[model samples]
Target: MLELLSYDFMQRSLLAAALVGALCSVIGVFVVLRGLAFVGAGTAHAAFAGVALAYLIGFPPLPLAILFGLATVWVTGVMEEQGRMKLDVSIGILYTATMALAILFIGLMKTYNAEVYGYLFGSVLSVTSEELHIILVLSVLVLGLIVLFSKELYFIAFDQEMAEASGVPARRMYYLLLTLIALTMVVSLKTVGAILVFAMVLIPASTAYQLTHSLRHMTAYAAVIGTTSAVGGVLLSYAWDVPTGPAIVLLATAVFFGSVLFSPKRLRRIVA
Candidate 1:
């Protein structure tokens, strides 16, 4: 295992996994808290449409996908606020429409590209140094934004009405949170791909929720769980010659179920 670190690609893969894991887990806490898991899923699929568009148009996918994801969020927010549609309803409609667009784009291609498949399912081992740099920069930006707005975000996540009453600009903070989620999804797309990115966003946070009520502790625990799953999955995928994205998601899922089995909250409820 230690010998693998000598290889540059392996080292980069591990580092990328750690960055993505920590970033996704942290953002996921808010997603879980705000009951926005569906939104996360929808945004990821919308980004998938962007990826397909990139492939079709011969442009870089990540930036385009980021734009697409952000646009999806903006549309959802607008529909909910101005068009008088529920968020879930807007998300569901947009999610399906974007997925249909992705399929349509795929069909339009005259010849299938294997690289596009990697975007669908992830190709972390193939990540280049430049791509890693992009991930690092974006990860730092996401973390910094989270730190700067931590209090406001926490207030909004737990009690939007109260936060708004307190003049916290709850609506704007919510949009910022969505932007962070979009950026995180774009950075993570190469590691876990569009299909499984939401699992990376969701599972570790859900696992931590089972173990703690404190937001601080939950965020920390989720990061640890996510990093562990990412590293472990990368190692397992290398050893077993399996797909890395699914491997990471499966490990995260295992941790979530394990947490459920031994959760103190579950035990307390049972005893009560």
Candidate 2:
């Protein structure tokens, strides 16, 4: 482990994993509370389309992912407003459609490259300093926004009707959260890929929820669990030469089950 840290790429991978894990878990609390798990999966698939587009056009993947993800966010919000599409249905269609398009684009590109598969499953060891900077900046921005709007978010999450009755901008907050989720999806793509991205965004928070009723406690615990899972997964994967993304998600799943098995909240509820 000490030898691993001595290498620049391993250090970068660890840093990226920590940042991505923290962001995913923090935001994932709201996602789980609001039942937006499907939306996270959809946004990840949309990000895959963005990456495919970027690869086909000879551009970087990150900006393209953000662009496509934000567009999907806006469109989904509009669909919700119009009462034209339920979230799960909309998300399902969007996810499959984008994934199909991404696959098609990859096939049409006429070149098979290892980087594509790396992006699909993750290649954190290949993360560059610039990518790290972007992840850091985005993580800070997302955390700050989440902090500033914690009250509103909590209200919106727990009681949308009450929040709106109390003059909270429910629609606005909904869109804001989706936009942030979109950004989260984009940044997380390089770490975990679209296929398993939602695991990072949902499992830790769900586990935390099992352990606590307070949003503050949930967020804190989720972040800790997520970071630990990511780091541990990376270390184990490095040692065993397994694929990183699924390994990380498997670690998160282990944590989720551990929390469920030992949750004081569950014990109290049972006793009550």
Best by TM-score: 1
- Residue pairs with backbone atoms closer than 3 Å in model 1 (clashes): none
For candidate 2, write residues 1-272 as lDDT tens digits.
Answer: 68889999899889999999999999999999998888888888898888988898899888888988888878887887788989778878888888898898798797886677666788787888999999999999998999999899888989888999999998788888999999999888888888888899999999999988788899999999989998888898899999888889998998889888889988887899
Span of ten consecutive residues with least summed lDDT in model 2: 110-119
lDDT of 2 at 217: 91
lDDT of 2 at 158: 93
Q: Where in model 2 is the C-alpha error above 4 Å?
A: none
* Candidate 1 accuracy as TM-score: 0.97
lDDT tens digits, residues 1-272, model 1?
78998999998998999899999999999999988888888888888889998999899988789988999988887787686888899899999999899889888988988877777898899989999999999999999999999999989999998999989999999999989988888888889988899999999999999999899999999999999999999999999999999999999999999999999999999999
**Per-residue lDDT of 43 in model 1:** 89
Candidate 1: where is the Cα deviation over 4 Å? none
Q: What TM-score does model 2 achieve against the real structure?
A: 0.96
